[model samples]
Target: MGVGGNFWDLLKPYGHKEGFDFLRNKRVAVDLSFWIVQHENAIKTHVRKPHLRLTFFRTINLFSKFGAFPVFVVDGKPSPLKSQARTARYFRSSGIELASLPVPEEGASAERNSLFSTYVQECVELVQLLGMPVLKARGEAEALCAQLNSEGHVDACLTADSDAFLFGAKCIIKCFCPNSKEPFECYNMSDIEAGLGLKRRHLIAISLLVGNDHDMNGVRGIGLDTALHFVKAFSEDDILNRLCEIGKGNASQFQINIKSEDNIEMDGNSPHKKQLHCSFCGHPGSKRDHMKFSCGYCAKKDDDEGCLRKPEDFKCDCFSCGMNRRQKEQKRLENWHTKICQKIAEEPNFPKDEIIDMYLCNDNGYFSANDGPHTVWGKPNIEMLIDFLNFHQHWDPSYIRRMMFPMMSTIFLRDMASTPAESLLFGQYEFDSLERVKMRYGYQFYVVKWKRAGGNIAFKVPSKESGTQDVAVELDETVNLLDDCDVPEIHQDDECSFLLTDENMDLVGAAFPAEVKRFWQEQELKDLKKRKNSASKSQENESPASSSARSIQLNITEFYTSTKVKHQPKQEESSKNNDSGDSNMKRNESSSSNLPKSVRRRLLFD
Candidate 1:
């Protein structure tokens, strides 16, 4: 329904580099009506509604994964200018009489119209559920898309409508291929101007002359090349002036003059010879031409045999050409519809926000000991995401985790014990040295490891004193406590690490259990004892003469004990064991071996 008959040929040199991957991390505004219309064939053919929903769902899903945030713009109502076409189509499709057409306000009375409306509603719902915002345009969806692109709300407008160019979209994607193997077909306004040597107004003028949805019958015999020539030569206002001048004068004569100038022959037999030949090829025809009549337009220059031409080339003023064009257009429309439906059905709708909130919260402030619901933080949500991916796509959970987890904000891990350990283990340790501990704001925190919770480290801070000695702490007091305890590096690691480190010894000593506190105290005592013993030895070593004499006396005693033990051991054992004693011992061992193996082994080994 756009500027037909190879309108793209003039702008082919301006075609954009293909591929949708470039759209990653970009925001695009989609013409939802275009999509629905493009998928109309699928909707009509399918028995259930899921086929339609699947189309939208899959398309949005691909966009999301590719990091393209799409804003779907749906048509609100048919424009007044396009009302005739809409009414005709409605009546034609529904098999309803034109006289029986319902008024706009009364809603569609035809079954086909009602079904189409329902499908549109379902599409909107599907997109909404997929988390893409849906906007109802006051006029056409393409117009809205163009506006959004112009306003910089989106990077581009995705539509097949050539009218989108007239609507002032800077960038338009003519076709989207969801598969990575097939690239998208895009067009840039800049490229168009550069390649075609025409501006926006000139393009609009050409559309007006060539015929479009708004103007069904443009100046006949004025094709793309002729339209381009006329537009380029005259200003937009001057072109309109010329059209008006021609309209007031002999329109047929003007068309013939234009056609003759382009070397197109007029019908010689006709009155005034004003009627022109076929625009595709210069052939004058009458109503008598049959379906098999050959077109000189589609014929080869050297070939005189016209009847044997390709079936598609038989474009005479015959019933066959009319039927051929209709069939081709219908087929093209159906193919386009099927492509959009498949794209929508294959893409996924991942719950990005819900998944993020499940894993991480914005305000990660710690709750007091008496506070309800301890945040388990990222673990459960990460697991949930993994499980969801596994169940839905049968993807490896590890791969999903690898791809997803690093994208989450680290602040959510504030309550987790591993947050600190990871920081310290990775040489990012940031705790103040021990001597800084002091009682500030009459509240302190001790870093304690919770054994029951798989040894998770956390900060233990006292709550506000209620009548029963437990109440919510005042905000000011809590602020002061945080300020006094606030160690920059420690906080960066986690609150737990900040409290547990050496800087908060006074709090640790008071708040930790006796065993935990005693363990630190014992280590300190041992260190002190070692230092004192070393000092005592240094003092003793200060008297060199006394140390030397003690060393000599010790050497003499060691020599005497070594000689006596060496001489006594060899003869003493031999004298004590006579032959008879040896025989008696052997007999006793033999008798013991006769006992049960267990008793014998126990007696021998134990």
Candidate 2:
């Protein structure tokens, strides 16, 4: 659909996956029609007017979650040359016949075209209501997207078109998948040039040779690989001109190898000459000599039948055979190159000047030197947005409000950053407190909670079952949304919390410096108090234990299962030798005689 040569595939290897934060604070040019068609294809199978739903949600996510200021570009008049390609594509996709009507509403293409264009208008309205800019292109939307990117009016172009590179786009997000952690297949032209060794003109040369949406019949025999090889031979400065020259039967000006077809023969005084081989033995020398006496290579004493006769598919691995094969391949390629050049010469106007001009020209009718369109973001009209979504999408007013809450909060924060004032969020809820910081994938967020002011609950309505009405004592932020999504849900509480992670730390710090300062101050003071208490407790526990100077220390000086020791007195007591040794002996003898029972007999025995 882009450039009929599978151009995106050629550039696929140079692409990288980028996270949502990659577009933070960047101005991106979006091919609005491309996104619409892509979404319609995916969702139209089941959902009614799927383009509406997809465009609505995807725009919200891109603006709020990705934090990008998007300029949506809608298509203008298509190139006259793309009519056939466009019609053919439609037929293939819809399985329609060639007999067609030119009137606006006569055919399937017409009906689809009318419906698609109407939806595109609706999307443009939605984008405007959402505060993003929309620009109409003079030619194709992608061309204008590329123009905006190349002119530095935008940081990147968001489109899946392969020809965006051909149109001089520096960087392109090949696709957008909002749910993925890394939601972009981003490609840079510098990487492609380095990886493929191909420049813009080289790409142009390739598209011109193989085909493009503008010219499906480029050359009869040219293909991607052959065209790639052909284009790389010439530098960018002369590639398009060389193509023009070849188109005008001036291919002889370019160097082409002279093609010759001849079979290999072992002849005298030739560079490729080799010794003749015995056909039956597959070795050096002639068969006649081998028949008379076994050749030296096949001369075996046990049994010799001249190398047991050559196998039917036997191939000689001699040096001459290798040289022969290389020469043949070289000649074949030369022949191929010659035929391709002839085909180029045969086509009338081989390189269409309009197609080349279409790609090479940088003026896309939307850019200017002094007065380009303003790239600044504007304030969204919430009332208008709710009405618009409700009318077109059949969505509830509550659902629309909840979905767009993120965008509104972002706008509010941005305003707070500029004004540096204490203001209610979206003029309805006031900042309650700063919840703890939450981090995901190495990015930090200020979890800020907000509470709706009393008597100002815009979300609260009359009770469903009340004859008159009941007092609204409390309010809940929860609501029933039309679709389940990753948009941060509002919990059932008077207060709601948000992970304000889209902004840089410096911006948020500038916006709410007092809150940030207070949080850090509290954290530091709390940490100090904890440390102080812990130190005091540790000291209190150590004081009583440290008061005692002597410690009853026990030591196990030996290793054994069990041991019994006789009781003994200390050294001080044992060393005391009484001076009255006779007295001590008489005391001990008297105590022993006083021991009872058969005292007389015991004394006699003793």
Candidate 3:
């Protein structure tokens, strides 16, 4: 379904080869989309959420064992317009959580929000374990990372999708299990452009014109080649104008036929002349209107209609059941966006330029238009906010707490039941639960500053420092001392003098809460006692089955092709069963027909 399978296809020959284990040792920044797809909780849909199925511990262990590093980046909520487009796509495909209401009465649909939140936590923990930085940018983090690379922040971006190409990444290396024999494929931007016959910038434009399956459905008739032609031939204004015109002629049968035919021949030429009917209206098309259908028969009355017979009009198959669904959804999102924008406006210390700079506008996508005064006094002095809670070190609980209070107050306003920390507590019902929300929304004090500078600033601030400093400080403050030295009774000859200055050990001690300390002490005693225990009992404990590998029973109720699919059954006896059931292995190859025609043609021919 992606990159004409050129990416996966390239790795096939190298699978089972030596040196592939190097992948585990390499630093790979996993994108949010990949995580969504691996999740077992969510039902499969046309637009896959890659956050599912990924085990936080397994990923961490994989990276740790191989001496590799991984940075997991979560995609932020998209623009209101983009989100609306996403919701509509889910509605059409019947595979997303768009059906859930703000207040649900009952069923799994209602549980989707909880499930989604839980899965995000799992993803965050996996990323956290690797000690790699995670970013929560407004758009896709892979794209943001690409932006970072352009500014020379990192060596390269590691992801699975070709869409990263659209974000201007100079290089993209496909990620695979280090244990797998597959050779990691590395694609350069210039090579990709040459192979695809489109420049890197044009890739974004083509993606926009053809539609991104993750965000929105591309125009039905536009394929890769046509989309490429579109970016080359038309300016941004021309593309928008074409969209408006095509929408107007949607009803004409001739136009729909032409588009349908265009979908078939992706090599840039058609055997038959392009039809002038609107696909949506089933009426005559107009070059002036770009064949968009407003009224089913309006375009037909024009001169173009004289050459063709009147097309029969049929009611939309799902119209009655779906009446006003689009409008209702649109209204809901518009209200949400307006409220958010207003809240941003009202924040006493809002940094307009920073927030504005967070998003980059291109012809491919339009960001929310800015309103309110472009200038405001100390209106949320970003620097003051930075200092009020020091960001020089790794972000700690208190820092998150303080930041949340102001951020929630500014964004949620009266809608929130309490302070950001309190409301989040209310939302999650626990303090530990704050990690995922923070991972997703927490402004890595560093990433935030980098974004604010819009590439004008340089210097990569280590996020780990911001995260660990307070714990280190607290530990240092709590250590017992007498005149800057340990008491004589406690300071035995064996007690190393170096322990007093070991900042890292002190920091670790500080990070351990009371119960944790007791548990560690007990574990140490257990180790001392282990040598005296009976050999038989130790043997029992050392059995392979007793290893502490977390086993998860994922009951995947997948809905596909109008049917439900469940994974291999789990029975007590099945614990020893190694039968790899073919029936349970349902990796449906998603059709890539929606991609650009040239790409499609390449796939079809390949």
Off by over 4 Å in 2: 45-48, 93-112, 177-180, 256-333, 456-488, 491-506, 524-606
Which candidate, 1 or 2, has the higher lDDT?
2
Output the worst ten-in-a-row residue range by lDDT, candidate 2: 474-483
Name the better of 2 and 3 by TM-score. 2
Predict model 2's lDDT versus the native: 0.71
Native-to-model Cα distance after best TM-score fit, residue 602 in candidate 3, in Å: 88
- From the highest TM-score down, the ranking of the candidates is 2, 1, 3
- Candidate 1, clashing residue pairs? 38-337, 54-345, 55-344, 55-345, 58-344, 58-347, 59-344, 61-348, 466-470, 466-471
**lDDT (0-100) at residue 416 of candidate 2?**
80
lDDT ranking from best candidate downward: 2, 1, 3
Q: After superposition, how far is residue 124 of candidate 1 from its true place, in Å?
A: 1.5
Error of 3 at 56 (Å): 3.3
Q: Residue-pair clashes per candidate, as listed?
A: 10, 0, 57
| Alpha-carbon lDDT of model 3 | 0.39
- Tens digit per residue, CA lDDT, model 2, 29-116: 9888877776455445444466666677667767765678899998877765666567666676797764662423322221236777
- Backbone clashes in candidate 2 total 0
TM-score of each: 0.40, 0.70, 0.34
